[model samples]
Target: MMLSSMTLSRKYVILGIAVAGLIGSLTSAGAQIQYQTGQNVAPVYEGWMHNDDGSIDMVFGYLNRNWEEVLSVPIGPENNVQPGGPDRGQPTIFVPRRFTQPPGERREQCVFRVRVPAGWGPKQEIAWTLTAHGRTDKAVGTLDPLDEIDTHVIAENRAFTITEGNKPPSIQSLKADPDTVTLPGTVTLTARVTDDGLPKPPAPQPGSGNAGGRGNAAAASSAVAALAFMGDASLDCR
Candidate 1:
């Protein structure tokens, strides 16, 4: 039976709509990595920092799917750097559990942040990847002179810079309840961290132009550091 022209046109239109929808869905899925329990997303380079030591430090971050899932990936296969490490010793990433987002928010939280030595000539590339339970996602960054990262603009002390006399936060104590627990049971973890870098508000030094109004102003960042928390995280105790 020969179909009418109108019926054939309708059929073609319906098929076109279905194809378009499928394409859109695929594109969206590819745009952002989806991670879940036993699965992980890719790592992204936020930017680089210039250490006091002349070497550039590559800052990387990643996402974890489950809210209660913690993760700890080392600097090796699955998540590694080319040409090997300078032995700066990348820490086992400590990713906090995921959390709920409020309305109108659309940024993925970086549960993990780490820095590695980067200065292997122009071709040096760092690849941060996550693969678990048969799923994999990876992100690569290069230190090439002509690479996408504007290393020139990322001058010394541009964003995050550490200099002499800088001290990191200290852990007073860390405790975990029911360290050894049966299956289907839960454990509680707690940490006590403190930083003494903050200085006590000092009295104005009586400067003519109020230059000393801001105590330790010289140590303060020239520009406010902007940080954003995106979505949630995964579950793999670091």
Candidate 2:
């Protein structure tokens, strides 16, 4: 009897340890999978703005679920925009999720635009569809009165405030040193950026903690042009 009791106690101890280890392993796996690869990309219809030529530009961006995966989906049945064509200046390469701010929103905004003539019906819709990682998602664009965005809205989304007469910095003489490159080769890009230097930083107050540093607005503008292409392939921007 004594021997049987000892054996039963040992068995219980081993079983408990195994169960605990299994639970711990599951928790570790769940945490590690938070930003795992092979996630899908979702199309985002940012908004629309009226162009000076009486045309409306429907802006779009994408949300790549994996923080570590950069997806290249060529234009085709899997990636397409409709109500005109499968391609309307949409990006073929979907980058990973950038910074996470404003909580729960992780999207690359204003990547591209599709122009609609001025007379386009307000109820008309343009759909941009993308399929990645075996999942398909779409973003629909319409002239929804609530969805109209102006320069101020765009600037706010970009985390910068633009006052009147504050024009966006421009990129001049942007070119890749070797316009053509063979595979496994690198190309250098050069560009000159100009800005009106509007929206100057606020003057340092008596003690607002020594005036937080300000970034170069022109440099930030120049980074927007960093998304370039080589031949027909979309180059990944690091």
Scored by lDDT, the top model is 2
- The Cα error of candidate 2 at residue 39, in Å, is 0.7
Models 1 onward score TM values of: 0.40, 0.69
Which ten-residue region of model 1 has the weakest summed lDDT? 222-231
Tell how far residue 200 is off in model 2, in angstroms.
Answer: 1.4
* Model 1 agreement with the true structure over 1-238: per-residue lDDT tens digits: 3568889999999999999999999999997764435555445565555566766666555545544345566555654544454222333443434233223322243333344454545555666655544566765655644433333343222333444554554655377787786756666656555555533434445445575554333333112111223212223323
Could you report the Cα RMSD, in angstroms, for every candidate shown?
12.1, 7.8
Model 2 Cα lDDT, one tens digit per residue, 66-97: 98777889888988999888878888877665
Top candidate (TM-score): 2
